[model samples]
Target chain A: MAKELTPQEMLRIDLTPPNKDWMDIPTVIKPGIYCYPAKPEKVEIVGMPNPHVWSPLDDDWGLPEDWKETFLEGMRERLNKHRSFKIFMDICVRCGACADKCHFFLGSGDPKNMPVARAELIRSVYRGEFTKAGKILGRLAGGRKITEDVLKEIWYYMFQCTECRRCSLFCPYGIDTAEVTIIGRELINLFGLNINWIQEPVANCYETGNHLGLLPHTFKQNIEFMCMDIEDFVGVTIEPPFNKKGAEILFVTPSGDVFADPGIYTLMGYLLLFEHIGLDYTWSTYASEGGNFGFFTSLDMAQRLNAKIYAEAKRLGVKWILGGECGHMWRVVHQYMNTFNGPPEFLEEPVNPLTGTKFENAKSAKMIHISEFTADLIKHGKLKLNPKRNDHLKVTYHDSCNPSRGMGMFEEPRYIINNVCNNFYEMPENTIREQTFCCGSGAGLNAGENMELRLRGGLPRANAVKYVHERFGVNMLSCVCAIDRAVLPASMEYWVPDVNVCGVSELVGNALIMEGEHDRPTDLRGEEIPGFAKAEGEEEVTEDV
Target chain B: MGRNLHKGLREILVHKKGPIVEKWRELIHKSYPPETAQFLKREKDRFSNPIGSSIEDSIWPLFDQLIGEADPSTTKKLLDNLVRVRAVQDFTPASAVQIIFALKQIVRKEVLPAAQKKGLLREYLEFESEIDRFGLLAFDVFMECRERVWEIKRNDLLKRPYLLAGGMCPSYMMKRGIKHLEKLKKEITQH
Candidate 1:
């Protein structure tokens, strides 16, 4: 018989963070980690190796004869290019103020995981190799030599860290441990030893359109399935436009949302809402995933992944793309993409085709969040919502980190939740809104092996949420990010057992007004929201917000 | 038994206290430009009030304790001042290439060994060869230390107080370095 899956055991094997530290590490491992079962392997999946994992160095996985020269040159380049690196190198007071902050340290009880000590792993070597005191008065003076062993330890320890940057917040000088991890990863990549797991997803993203390796046809099939789900779940033949040329708005979502549960539910809400509103929108299988794992790996990979959006949008000749709720996707678009990809000439500045109000010079492409769009429609009296349809469960919204911190998307989702749900309680401030914690599985560490770390990492968020669930009787955890749907459920199932996770759209789908022949009387227990009939006056359009 | 020693070593570093802190105004003046430093010092009461004392007053006890505890073998205090002179022989060059050069010297020779003897070195140097191979140089020291840390025998190393003491060593000590008596005192006692 197959061994029974204990929460701890399954979490260790599935989540990719090193397993040895999970039980003993000082950090309290939250139940939120290990959100999914590890995919069973039959024949090992073979992927093409990208020869360009390293830049300005030899491509081999081992040190070449000129390794020292390569290493020095790489260090000099990093020092010259990033002021953050220089500040990091110069400013660590090693006061150990950041020691208690790392979840890995708390979970593993390994002193090496302590942020200050972890930094010293690099700082000591940098001092020993680059400066005068380091050369002669080595260990006593604070200098440490970088040997082959040091490199391997760096690979092992640095990779274990999630690059959360929480440590940086408390740090007096703002030393980003994530930067150190990136530099370490860059060095290891120089050696060509990017293990098969992470590299495979990156490779798949390059070959197929998504990290999950779903081809365009498969992607289209999933979208069609979501439309079918909308028909079944909410009584409407909600036809979603896929790959339609010259649509007013091109809707792009993470492909995972199309294939998964609550995410698919959110997608269904969008389809039904769009159909009811008579809005022109299309879903692109080409730009399927808004959540880019490439941003986590390298700057170049990030650029490559983002470059696809413009390519597909231009091909479709759409005006202003609408991005789905994803953490890093919003971060990349808001922080980097608008500047990186220019002259969105393929899409004109979004004009309220209804209001004729042009949103020019929008910081983020005039792309509207679905939550904001839905809430706006509600505010304009476009949809008649029965909030009592969602009265069965008390729901609370968990802010996706990128939208909360990356873009100031605090209000939109909450607006939808308040308008649609009969009862909604706010998660404690420490765990919600701008200070919201990650789902413990964002940034593609959602694999089975890293689940324990995810749980451990997500403890702070889980604990805060659990307090409300225990005291306030909150039953649902709602968020906008698809990955939150994927990861937070597992976390909630384990740690905060009182709550079930749902999308803001799932609630909207539950309460959405399906327009009828005439304005009908609204009832709490038994009537469907008015269903959508074709809108009149398409000939002489008037847009009023 | 060895693991117990390792555990003991960790305790030493974890428990080690640094110098009793003194002279915050002087130290603040050293890191920041005069205007910023003066403003910070003026606003020192604002920071220290909730925490109990001015950063200048608060940090001194810790600094002085670390300085007082530093091994006399390596660091020598001046007759009239709290400034401890680290002997620049065998490890650090007498003429520094840069300010960090002096730090590299003090860390590799005096600070690291004191840490090592007390079992604190394990955190900084996991392998025996890390101590051996990265024989006290700047970038190369980091390089060698990196190599040494990966050595298999590093698994067997003990955690000690000297290693813990290293944790108390400020980031400044590894950079431009203990230019003043108060900084020296803080560094000595903090561990």
Candidate 2:
């Protein structure tokens, strides 16, 4: 006879919450979820406070002796300095409108990951420490003292946010929840609790002028290697100048484009496009990075890293600056760069030398995005584009969170795609445009140890791609972001293996019909063009037969 | 293998498919927090609530495959859709596949009475055994997804050796007492 289960035992899998409130639920820091803590040396290099070795898994994080006072003091300082932070904390009515909008919440199904609750993790402490009624009434007034566990919980969820601002878009009162997370991270960094994936990049960007810390020679050599590939594949020999003074424009891009795959192809696209137009621009080794990891750490650090861009431009005496395909780089540049390091008085307003169109939108920053430049060029019929070159690719666009929401660059990339790729499709309306989902690995959260978090957060974006893949046979997903180029390939491979990720410039490079070029046998990646090269297995099958 | 027994089990499973799938989905929804479970249950749009929509879109075809033909290819694809979502979520390996086992309980409650009256209780026991096998298959798919996640993590690290090489910053090298910064830089360049 088989054993029988009792009535209570029969239904063993119970997932309901405990009798205690969410505040009482202790955070369990799991491996493969949190990133490695920042190294002490990296922290010390930046002269940040309380440099020490620590782990999220440790019972004691080895915080400074005055950690509580330091945290409260930081919070008080932020509340005084940034009125937006103070208003965001005070204005939220617990509307829950932004609760379901977070990708982390949607992916993980954790209530704490909800924007409202995540904010309340800090808000509760604020009320307890700052408000008179809360100090008097305690838990009755929806306030709690900042225990070590509370600090731990705040740190856990703050880093979980990508600061993509998706949730902020949905907030009725315009809470700007990303700012809350930014301030939360700033406070966390006061104790040197930053993650290595972010801190190392910040230190490297400060010391060597790029996130990957490639020295001037190595950076130039990497671009030269890409030039060699362009020569081999496109039958065009080009020498892109580096740090050349008196150039008309200073072209800066995230260093990922120089060193990483897919992004390097986009860099190749930039080289080809510039060469085709005979535009005068120089790459700066000092401002090699456009993306700022310091933006994820703190505002002051972001300003420090971002100062190099304008400084390089002033030194080079370029007329204007043109930025490349990157996500947060644009967010920082468009929204915060001018405020951080500008009134770039040394530079002139950005004007498309090829099209002769003055970019009024970028007049203040004296910087223009690559898509803005390319779109203007195409609109004016400046380039001879062959859309048929991309016929083999059925393409779709992923509105990288920053460019879409932060910059409102909705039509430029799509207009460029229409001119380049014949088979362009939109994902479901809700998942695109201003409502675009994050690639999940934004901010500094795109580290290897946080793979589970990234994958779960990426599901919505990947699911939208899957829908288009099934409906429209969309195989290639393009975007105007280098971080997307770096991370989306892994997400696409995991969620929808059929779709491949690429930069928009890669598509432009494919469709570009350069003067004095040989009959192109391949795209920028050296994969054969559909009509140019023989189909796969055709000759082999004939030989076998 | 008896023809009448197969016919009886198929008819009962097909007739009770609606309630069976609903109860199974409800149990799966329970696996999340109460507020999120309510949201996932209430929201019907596929794009706005993909997690919910994936569960809804998959369970119907999954049930049909379970009761009708049990085609391995179709069933595996359907299971992959559902299991892949849960694999990256905050579930342990056992809890991740436990959703499949909920169907066993649902069947025992919904089909047991009818099967007993129709003299098909033994067939029902065999059917439960089939559910056990399906649970085992779901476990395999879950593990495959978990392994793929690890593979992706490993590949991401390998793809960006510069990040790790850069991690050996000059100050970090000094702190670690590694004197050969030049050697490490050479290796990174070669890599």
**Native contacts recovered, each model:** 0.00, 0.53
The DockQ of each candidate is 0.01, 0.33
Q: Per-prediction interface RMSD?
A: 24.0, 5.6
Q: For candidate 2, what is the DockQ-based docking class?
A: acceptable
Give the poorly placed runs of model 1, Cα more than 4 Å off: A1-72, A95-111, A131-137, A140-143, A172-175, A195-197, A343-346, A351-361, A364-368, A516-545, B1-191
Output the worst ten-in-a-row residue range by lDDT, candidate 1 chain B.
B80-89
Q: Write the per-residue lDDT of candidate 2 for residues B1-191, one digit (tens) a residue.
A: 12233678878988999999999999888888788898899888888787898889878897776666677777778788888988998886778888887888898899899989899888888777777777888888998999999888866754454334543332222223223544555576799
DockQ of 1: 0.01
Worst 10 residues of 1 chain A by lDDT: A34-43
Best by lDDT: 2
Instruction: Name the regions of candidate 2 deviating beyond 4 angstroms.
Output: A1-20, A534-545, B1-5, B162-191
Each candidate's number of clashing pairs is 139, 0
Docking class of 1: incorrect
lDDT per residue, candidate 2, A1-545, as tens digits? 12355877665655544545787777877777789999999999989988899888877888888999999999999999999999998989998999999888888888898999999999999999999988999888888898788998899999889888999888999999899999999999999999999999999999999998888887887788778778878878999999999999999999888877678889889999999899999999899999999999999999999999999999999999999999999999999999899979889998898778999999899999999999999999998999999999999999999999999999999999999999999999999999999998899998888999998889889989999999999999999888888889989989999999999999998889887776677898888988978666655223345
